[model samples]
Target chain A: MLHEPATPVGKDLAATYKMRLGVLMFLFYSLFYAGFVAINLLNPLLMEVTILPGLNLATVYGFALILVALIEALAYDLFCRRKEQTLNNTQNTQGEGN
Target chain B: MTIIIFLFFVLLVIGLSLYLGKKAKTSSGYYAAGGKIHWGVNGIAFAGDYLSAASFLGICGMIATVGYDGFLYSIGYLAGWIVALFVVAEPLKRLGKYTFTDAIDSKYNSRGIKLAAAISTLVVSVCYLIPQMVGAGVLVEPLLGIPHGWGVVMVGAIVITIVATAGMTSTTYVQFLKGGLLILFSTVLVVAVCVRGLTTQPDQGGNVPYYEYTTLAAVNESGQIKVSDAGWQVVELQDIESAKLTFAKLAKDGKETWWLVSEKDGAVELHETQSVVTTRDGQRLINGAPASQDNQLRQVSNIEKLRGASDASTGSVSPIELLAAVSDKDTQINLWKEAALTDKDGGKVTIYYQKVTPGNQVMRPGLKFKVQGTPLERADFLSLMLALFLGTAALPHILIRYYTVPNPASARKSTIVAIAAIGFFYILTLFMGLGAMINGVLNPADSNMAAPLLARSFGNILFAVISAIAFATVLGTVSGLIVAASGAVAHDLLDRFLNLRMDDHQKVRAGKISAFVIGGLAIVLGILYKGMNVTFLVGLAFAVAASANLPSIVMLLFWKKTTAKGITASIIMGIVSSLVLILLSPDLFKLYGLDPATAPIPLSNPGIVSIPLSFCTLVVVSLLTGEKAKALKLAAQQ
Candidate 1:
């Protein structure tokens, strides 16, 4: 008991904001991915239906999972930076509050 | 030409690594690139490190062989990064100094945590390494006209040099370059496939040109099979009663092969113009002849009939048009299947036979994973998806990459970039695999050769370029793995757990030594697991990582009452349970030359069970130890 049990401080002013947003985006993407897997498991025949010209549900859904991950990642990054900027600006306006 | 390109790439990586090695004198420099890597560069490097031979070779080969089931891997692998970007990247960067163990053990600094995490890292890395080493050998066979053992050793040597010299810095650059070139060349190859469009006859002007299977009419009178064609004769025939399907074993010209048996208007039809038979006496037989340039497994995949096309080929079409053409009901494509049986003389015979499948069927599921087959089969598919979706963030090599970036934001930025690059590359895998499926370039015995061989179908130069990138893909990934493994050994096991009190200089030296040892071990294991499928091996690695590390990482970050003992115990449980379950699973049972039906566990993938087991273990242990830990913490604070 001579030393402090090093506890992980995973939350901070910005970290709390980031983690909340990150989990939300992650859950949204997770559901989208799960839906793709669910369709394959439950009704694989549905994957055969043509959803676009020259494209079926299987190919379209597969591509969408990948594209959505990319879009979500970019969007997540943009949102985090904007929110962090506001946090920094607010803290600066009320200097030495802590 | 392949050898020249391959050598140039290898030498360039080594030369650059040696140049960068001078700057990597400190522990941070060697292990985490001194936390100075640019987000843009690190992003592609992430792709380079992540997209191993499994992504390029195995997935393409799977798609070429099994269709849409292969793209499912692409989906799961890319989806896993969402967890990394959102949950792991920033937090891991803020906490860890070097190694995945560092991040997980940052709060506890317990010997138990160090030991468990370090062992898990080694297990996952070695599992991931076997496939890369095997893929390196597979790629090198065509590159240097060599056997697999030497190719594995050569790759090991190259990757070791990359790791031993410049460390993470050199590895990052190599990965970045490989990642960029791999994407660029794949796009080029995909465009070429689109431009070439749907062709009934592929390998247009090759020495061994592709032709559709010739179905011969025969009268099955008792045991004698009399064929209408004079050149090809079925000397002896025996019907196979398996899977409720009809197949006949035929012996002709001292070679054995399997034929699809069907009756048209009462006359038995023997289909398949080509089949490769590997005999008991170590002879490779193709179409009842010794395997040679002239006599080989006929270029396997080709369109028997193009869908809605008026000509012999659908002249230059768009990528969408290509997919549409392949997805048509009228489109008939040639695919291959393997069958095995005991010969008349008691020797085991393996035969690869051609099958005619509708384009619509070839583009859908039910080929590989069997999603709708049975409850267990569906569970296996779901387990694999869960592992892949969770495994990316849990992998030690991936976690360590966050340490290479300067800040948490940089880590997040790099991961987003990795998602874009890797997602684009995975989409191209579908195009490349579809092209290979119809282009008649896939090796009958090895689906892993699909992408490089598909590039070969385009032209020799593209093949050479793609082959070089594949080799570099192996190198980049293997180096990253070695770096992770070395950090675990030198930093976690020796320095942290063993309390060796190694200085920064001593630690870097020990890390280099560990890299050499791991490289040597990898080469030996690669040679041992020579015939294993790369994708399957990588999947097992993912399962282990997900089961072992993900729970501990997630709970440690989220749960307020999580203790060191809880983290340590769960990691061991995860590793042991997953390994045991994998050992008893049907897939490994089949690999062991035993009846898969005899496997104790029905599930081939254990993530569905083992991951939850790990989480339960963590929660139980944490609750049991919460009071003592709380008292100790309170005492220390007071």
Candidate 2:
């Protein structure tokens, strides 16, 4: 059975993990948010062009959302695996101290 | 065809529920499918339970009426599943016993946590259930010509019986069945669309010219306006009368064919008018206005009328010529109302609609969102978008699905599957909506009828199957919600908080009873909130869920420093604040159309402001109370 190990952090590890996670989350959320804002703002403009044809903002946003979600899921899995590896290494070092 | 298929499918669902009820003898068996369902089946069931009537019906309706904007909802909904898969799924499955409260109280053993979590679950689940019930009512009203209220009651009774008898076992199977049927049939429908191909000419089926009568002053030859005896009706040279036009039949072609009216001395002449008007903006104003209601003048019939010279049956025109012939500028019909003529009863009597050329303003978004003399309504639009994006992740029924799976791995896998299924379905929505728009099956009376009516165009059998699937979609979702609420009441409140110490069998029985009670309440609310958009109601549910449950769950999961007091405070505050904000919002005021002072708040969704507030309260209170609680616990241990 694989068990999660608790590592004693000297503040640095905790801060680093927190900062990395926060940045990643912010980036992921912001990308989607930017898409949303852009579509809502530009939709009306797109409607103004006579030859271009009316575009459905929802369909475009939906496609963007699916793509972003796929990327975010992949990023999250990678982060978790990396974090797990670090935690495992720390546990091994603490066992040597004991 | 619609009635027979709908009844047959509903009966099959009910029969399956009854069978599952008998098998679900234990509490775990009833509440969480004995926590032993296959990941693959549960994944599809997740799709079934998640894709409610709102997704299938409301989205298609929105697209038919509002064009591209309607498809945006599908994107928001599917995106929420990503949050579920990575953030909540695994940890939730690992922590909770049977209910969401179990997860929170497992670490703390606090009565306050149990009570707060239970309350939040009940509130969110109930809010979610109302829309399903409303959708059920809407479906039944059109299918059987019964009142919407009766439909709500019937769905309520059926769902309650299902949940009360079998619990999650029944709910899962029903959702699984529905999920499979929905995907299979919708795919078939999409293929049908590809096969039918896009045609400019109207099919031979009976088609009506889309008409709207606007009232204006009517003038005579001498420029004298003709007035009725009551002085309400005026017959001017160019009189316009606005009449509330109801939809009779869908137009066969994408362009409406009309007999242009030119009146002289109240005598009318009919001229064949056909032309497609394009707005200066990119929007293709079919006849004269926006494709649908948001723009005043655009009208596109389902199929365009084929000219005599271009008739393919006569082998007179090639396919390219057929397309070109219908696309010709002269092939569009534009209708404008003359004037309002009032009768002796003080009511508008004579109304005239004349075919004319459509103008540029028809294709643009009107002044609805714009404030007078102010900048664009960015704030209001942003707030709404935020509410939609965040609300789905916070919904209680969705959150509870994590508990239904056995392990975190399964939960994660299920969420991924759900996202894939939901995403695909959303893609289909574009075609479905466009197909309905061009096929001439859109119900002007209700946009919600788009998908089913679209099916009707193919034949009665397809219509019956589509309608049945739609009804089943409502049933599956409503059952899941009622089950969630019932579990909250029985397991969290009675067993945990009240300290009943009941066996699994007793707990299951209690849950069943609660399901009936809550289901009845949902029916009443659904009937009261009729004629409103289901999608908007769903937004409200998401807002409340995000505000009430999200803070508590997030705090418990990440912040070890969080105390019993902090969790309780946060849950109570989140629920109260969000509910209070929604009740006071502009929607409530506008719904009543009365004094703003009488209403509590000006905003419709509280997620924009209330979600942040809840998170802040949790953080501050946790920091303040954590140390003392830990010290007390250490002292006790010593």
Candidate 3:
């Protein structure tokens, strides 16, 4: 595909970076979610233990999943922004040299 | 008063639709809101569209009845948006102009791809529509004093008006309005739950049961209901026309009692209630009053504090304390347990009994999805979860929302906003459900009514507001689905495949006509599926979408070698396989008034099998065709 030259150069750059980060976050989140489900399947008794005052492990784990989603969203946005900035800086420098 | 508020909300929404309709002269405006919606509003609208009856009414009811199992749905639904935000939102917006099918057909204007994708969209959208319509019917009976069928028809008419008038623009605003109000009012209800706190306090104001029963000696026209001290004589009966099953009042020694009668062979038998009474109107009341809105039980029952902390019933604990207290093993909480009882007619009627469950057990996962059940049952549970987690990003209606934004970045931003709003709302459901459980406000017949009934426990005013908001929730979701289905029909099927060569005006007109047809279809299905749990129906839709649509969409975005033929084949495989599996699944058999055990398919959800099947179809076909064919097709299109 690269030799064919049909694809844009920067398109792969952003796509690669985004895909890598996105897959990583997705896998990481899935592991946590799977853990919750696995625990429910394997030994549901663990969910009964109070991890905090007035809160059980199951409830805490559920809320933690939501927090993790928010954090991942923010992290992805920042990472993409930085990548775009780097790409723009290189283009500017090349233009100046020309 | 409730009716007045409901009327106001309905009129306001209809008026807004007509106002927005003026701008929908063009197909772009009608289909994608002219790609002019603000990212912020669109994000909230996404939440509105996604929440539906399942998230608001279904999850809460599940939690109220079963405990921690319901929150799992919230987690699965929200996790799916992460896929949308990180992977799908930007790419879909960049690719498609109006509809989700456009994103795929953009590469090659293949009529096969258009036809297959359009059919899948319609199937998934209609499956999704059934639950929303069912939820509307559930709300109508209790809130508007109307029959369930009328409520479904009312929703269909309103949704058609909205979709046919202004299309996406009207849908978006209605979604945005309802979404914001749903979150706001839910927070109010959650706070009220917190203020009221956990209580083991028995209902004193309403008709209180004087005795509890383990069993009855006999039941007939002259059958006797056994009490601890003495027995009662059978009186008038209801629902026993065939002399199979009935509710009756028994008068014994100047005191009256309620008994459930079961007739077997030539003999009549009686089952005594745990707590029951006979009202002046000869109505058999359980606990205190009949299981109607007139019941005054307004607080959580069968409660206790942490095991070692105190044996006494803790009164008015804080919200956090309430949850923590329920997690303790010693805390005796009341939860509903359902059992299917065989009536005299040999049919099954599922009856829910109030059980004194330990808090530790309630907080655990085994109550609903029992691991101890058959292997197939356990597999079905996992399949349901997988579908829910994958379905959100694949939904035709959700995908179209991305095109409503200006750019890929806006699409990404709006999705994140959706996650935040939706996540917050799901958390509130736990409290609302728990509140409903303790408050004795649940309608024993319909789990869908738990959230609204919880509000009614606060007062009629709050009930009116929540019910109206819930009605809007159904309307917004149903309208969005109808619009998506109509687009698939008009734009993808007619214009692209049939080569109708429709102008913008003709396209909009065709779409509107399609909306009316699909809306009517949804209304009919909803009435047919009455009394079924709304949330479970949604689970089926998710499974279908995950199986049929997700594989093709994901492969198209990622794999360069994915041919139009591969895409077409995969979609057909996905749709056909999932539909066949679902039709053969036990649950559908149960719906058809057949024995569930006789169904060939073991798993209820088709995602675990059909999703992988669809993926393999896409890959195998792509590999067989090789990349050269795709390259030639692309060149030809250019």
Name the candidate that leads on lDDT: 1
- Candidate 1 residues lying further than 4 Å off, grouped into runs, are A1-12, A89-98, B205-208, B222-225, B228-233, B238-240, B245-258, B278-282, B308-311, B628-638
Residue pairs in clash, model 1: none
Whole-model Cα lDDT of every candidate shown, in order: 0.85, 0.64, 0.79
lDDT of 1 by residue, A21-81 (tens): 9989988988998898899899988888888997888888888899889999988888888
Taking all chains together, each candidate's TM-score versus the true structure is: 0.94, 0.75, 0.86
Candidate 1 lDDT over B244-287, as tens digits, reads: 44556565666556677778687888886455555677777666
Per-residue lDDT tens digits for candidate 3, residues B513-568, read 99999999999999998888888888888888988888888898889888888899
Show model 3 residue runs off by greater than 4 Å.
A1-15, A88-98, B202-228, B233-316, B340-351, B627-638
Clashing pairs in 3: A54-B324, B207-B288, B219-B269, B219-B270, B299-B438, B300-B438
Q: Which scores better on DockQ, 2 or 3?
A: 3
- RMSD in order of candidates: 3.5, 10.0, 6.6
Local distance difference test, candidate 1:
0.85
Query: Roughly what TM-score does model 2 have, to 2 decimal places?
Result: 0.75
Per-model TM-score of chain A alone? 0.76, 0.47, 0.75
Cα lDDT tens digits, model 2, B433-511, are: 6567555565444677788877766777887898889888998999888888888899888988898888877888899
Question: In candidate 2, residue A79 scores what lDDT?
Answer: 64
